[model samples]
Target: MRIGLYATGQAGLEGIVEDIAAAERLGLDSAFLPQLTAWDALTVAALAGPRVPRIGLGTAVVRTYAQHPLALAGQALTAQAATGGRLTLGIGPSHREIVEGGYGLSYDRPARHVREYLQALRPLLRGESTDFRGETLSVSGTVDVPGAEPPPVLVSALGPVLLGIAGELADGTVTVWAGPEVLGEYVVPKITDAAKRAGRPAPRVVASAMLSVTADPDRVRADIRGRFGTAGEFASYRRLLRQQGKAGLEDTVAAGDEDFVAATVARFAAAGVTDLLVSPVGTDEERERTLAFAARLR
Candidate 1:
């Protein structure tokens, strides 16, 4: 499995570019920038592309509620060209709270919205025009980006319905808060079966987790809980945690010494993960230790 870093992009543009460059220096496969409240991930990737030449640049997820499919396709293709085709476009229908409360957009029938979004998006990414009409969206356009190949699209899917949709429509699924048990027993089989039914290739399983190589594992876990406890409360994440028999987000973390962390990562690889994105959590020294250990795994 390819191992990479999950960048929060809290660091400004230059910091983010430096982070990607450092990830490349460490031999990580990719640097996935999240679309949080800070800098725009696609724009950061486009700007960082020319700086960090080898490492892959991806959006852990860009919300689809606010942006139209046609518009996003153009931006993704432009980034793809700028990054020399080292871009993976990961998009999703964000949580209902975030969509309705934050974006002031309707979150009705997210599955249908994603279905319609992909139906129109896939064709445009391939430089083909799409004249489709669906309940949630209607699009008739094509995106043209010379010297840019279509980047693989992955959906941030957790539940069975969205997993099926991702399998049939997307290149893979990007999962967070799912442990090896959930991936092996639930996620991998569900998506793989759906892909087989759709006659698509094996789907990429990109698992994101908080990990640290620290002596005080308990402290790191507590810190993680303090920071990310609310994430476990999210409907989708709560469901995933339940599937894994985990109490909260901290329960999903892989923290300990080198041997323990390595064994945890091995479990993910054995569970059929195609890529593992490590979100290191700890003091600066411990985070660096975690990154160095993760690079050794590569």
Candidate 2:
């Protein structure tokens, strides 16, 4: 399995580039940047792409509602060109709370929204024109970046309908806050089956997990719960936790000593995860330890 480091991109732009460079130096396969209250992920990719020559760079996800397909496709192609085709465009219709409450955008029929979004976005990324008119979206245009290859696209999908849309329209799915049991029984099968039915290549299953290697697993789990309890309240995450027989976000954390942590990561691979993004959590010491350990996995 390909291993990636989840660089939150919480650091400033230059710091973010340094982080990716650091990951690449550690022999990691890729660096994934998240889009939340930080530098724009794609923009950062454009700036940092040339600096980190060997590693794959991707967005854990960029919110689909914020940018039109034409606009997003243009930016994605540009990033691909800058990165020499090392970009993976992960897009999602974020939660209703963030979309409706934060951005004041309609969060209606998200599955349909994403399906339509991909229908318009994918062709544009391939330097082809699109004339699409769906109930939720209507777009006509082409986005071209000279000498740029279309980057692979992934969707952040959890539920069945969205998974169907992801397998049908996108290259793969990137998942967060889900455990191995959920990946094996629900996520992998659904997406893979959809891809097979569509006569597409095997879909990539990229799972992101909170990673910590420590002598005290309980303390790390508590810290994860305290910091991320709100994720448990999100309906989509709640269902995923339940599928994994977890009551809350704390229960879903993969924290342990080195041997145990290694075993947990292997479980994800056994569950058919094509890529694993390890997000270092807890203190500065713990984060560094986790980063070093995950780097060694490469």
Name the top TM-score candidate.
Answer: 1
Candidate 2 lDDT at 66 equals 92
The models' CA-based lDDT, in order, is: 0.91, 0.89
Q: Which stretches of candidate 2 lie over 4 Å from their true place?
A: none
RMSD of 2: 1.2
State the weakest 10-residue window (summed lDDT) of model 1: 7-16
Q: Which pairs of residues collide in candidate 2?
A: none
* Model 1 lDDT, residue 209, Cα: 82
Q: Give a tens-digit lDDT track for model 2, residues 24-94.
A: 88888998888886689999988889999999999989999999999999889989999998999999998
> Which residue pairs come into collision in candidate 1?
none
Instruction: Give a tens-digit lDDT track for model 1, residues 1-298.
Output: 9999998755577887888898999999999988877789899999999998899989989999979999999999999999999999999998987899899999999999999999999999999978999999999988889889999999999889999999999999998888888898889999999999999999999999888998999999999899889877778888777777889899888999899999999999999999999998899889878988899998
